[model samples]
Target: MKTPVVYVALQQFCEADAAPRQRLLEAGFEVRQNTLGRRLRREEVPTFLAQADAVIAGVEPYDAEVLAALSKLRCISRCGVGTDSIDVDAAQRRGIAVYTTPDEVTEPVAQLTVAMILALARNFPQHLAASRAGRWEKRTGVLLSEWTVGLIGFGRIGRAVARDLSPFGPRLLVTDPALSSGEAPDGVQRVELAALLAQADVVSLHASRPPHAGALLGRHELASMKPGSYLVNTARGHLVDDAALVEALQSGHLAGAAIDVFATEPYTGALSQMPQVLCTPHVATLTRASRAAMERRAAAHVVEWWTQASCLTPTS
Candidate 1:
């Protein structure tokens, strides 16, 4: 029998941890990593994984055309949540199994969500910039306790954020169409999306990407939010209409926004130049501990599939 080949498609896979490579070698597999320091362009994907049996992937696109060209590729163990980047339906048709490390990202992302909300509320970025420039002024910031915190999605990260917000004693409102009203935990009121928009002083997006729907936070939705209310998106970036968000922030309709992901990554969009926005490089799951854990687990899943579980598609 030939030693199966494994491809590591994530750019930062081994930087935080080297154990994954050792594990693959111990399992009698040949491991190759993405050599390009950045994401591979669309044309560069197919040829890269042509001879591989499995791949530990990042947020790169796996469209139908890309999947069609892979002759030996069979599994993609995603290093993070949100399989939106991969064409799962297409992969399914081609017998290419997909997996993700959903649990590894939950805590780190939830922690950052809380951190962004507090930072925006207290003007942390602005104050730090001003102090650096030798200008000092007292700017009274809003308190989380004084605002109605509305969560759009009630899944793993959303519920985790709610639990983290409990000590602050803010009014909590939640709306997830997938969940019944009775499913809401105590102290969190389940409401309609529109009602939540009208009432929340701070709206944080935690919703998963809905299939075939345009951005959930488009013009109409942003218009419905309370004036001066803030937004924090550590979720999928395509959830918001960037053009709409930029206009809102510029016109002073929305007070500010803190975003970790973007519609297009390596994002050099207009939002990057705005003063009212705080941006991160799609790295809510980039903690050293979380990255190391996720990479190891993702690599393990790939080898596990090759050894004993290729017939069954493992849950991400």
Candidate 2:
């Protein structure tokens, strides 16, 4: 009997922790991992995953065309919480089950969001630049307690951010379709998106990216924000329009911005050149514990699905 193959397409997996990959081996599946140490390009995906019966996926594109090419692929176990990279509807049509480790990444992402808010509030980038250049300069910064923060989504990550920021005493405004009128948590006000944008001193994004929609914060939305306020996004990159944000920063409408995710990764864009912008390489969920947990959960999903499939198949 031929052993079923599971391909690990995540750029970094099971390096510090081997339990996830070990579990796959003990489950009697041959496993393959990306050796390039980077995200696989769209064209390279099919070639690498040609013989895989399942894939432990990353942010690499798995659109309809890619899903159709992986003839043997039966399931995709995502290492983190976003389906933006995958064509979920197409996967369903192709009989491929899609799974994500949503809960495992919540704490890490929330922690990053808080850190970005603090960094921007205190102008960490400007301070660090002067210190690095051997010049002693001090920039006046605002206190979190003095500002009102608007959270764009009320999901697991959004709630976690609210919890962490509550003790800091910032007035919290939340706008989510799920949070109806009079449904907000204690100390949090549920407001419309326009109200939140207008009232917030720090507008943070924790919302899911809508499918096939334009940028959530275009020119009009960015313009509506409180002057000299900050923006933080640890969510999907497409939520904010890059050009619009750049314009806002240039005009001094926004004090600063901290961005972790970008529309195109390995980002070398205008924002990176802006001193006020604190850009991270989408490492919000890259903490050791979070990465290990997410990888294990994703691996377990693949094994569970494969085991069930094997049991259902007729013996030769």
Candidate 3:
């Protein structure tokens, strides 16, 4: 009998370092690697996954149409925490089990968020730029104690960021419709979105992408923020209106922003030219520890599904 095939659709990283793939192969499975070296389009994914027994997906879209096209697909193992890329309802309807590596990425992302917050507060980028040009100008920076940090969502990542930020002695405000006052973190007060927006000196986005089609932060929210406030987003790019953010930055409404994710990734756009904005190539969770943990768990999920004929779907 032919070995079952497992398809992997990772675009940015090398699968050669993927320990999970090695584990699967050792367990007597055949791995069909990426069909293309770059991110595959929606049309290309179905053709590749049609005969696959299992798939380890990255940020590629796995909607109802793509899910329906996969006749032999048994399970989808996500490399990271976010399920926004996959159609969960469709997967459930088709009886295809879905799993994610949430626990793997929590600490690394939390560390990155704190790093960006500090970098923004200290004007690190501006200082570096001036030093590179042979200037010795010392830039003034805001102390974390004097600032209020607002978290937009109170999930695992948000909670971890809150814990890390606690040591800095900054006041914490969290906004999540699902979280009641009783559920707020220790020393962190739960508040309405508008109140958080109005009071925060540094606003960090940790919310999941809602299925809606409009900007979560528009002109009004931006205007409501304190002048010279900073915005940091390690979450989904669509959560903020890029155009509105650019306008705020250009008009000096915001002090600066450190953004790790974008609406259109591998971003080549006007935002790249802005001096006040610090952009990372969506590598907040690219640490060796995080990568290894996520891959191992995702591989284990697939192995368990095959051996026990059951799913390991995480609730939350």
- Taking every candidate in turn, the Cα RMSD to the unseen true structure, in Å, is 3.3, 1.1, 4.1
- Residue-wise lDDT of candidate 3 within 28-86, one digit each (tens)? 77877775766667888888887798888888888898998998887999989998878
Model 3 residue runs over 4 Å out of place are: 12-18, 35-37, 132-135, 211-213, 310-316
Q: Candidate 2, residues 191-239: lDDT per residue as tens digits?
A: 9999999999999999887546878998999999999989999998999
For candidate 1, give the lDDT of residue 231. 92
lDDT of 2: 0.93
Pairwise lDDT winner, candidates 1 and 2: 2
CA lDDT of every candidate: 0.88, 0.93, 0.85
Model 2 bad stretches (over 4 Å) = none
Each model's TM-score? 0.94, 0.97, 0.92
How many Å off is the CA of 77 in candidate 3? 0.5
The prediction achieving the highest lDDT against the true structure is: 2
Error of 3 at 259 (Å): 0.5
Q: What TM-score would candidate 2 get against the native? A: 0.97
lDDT of 1: 0.88
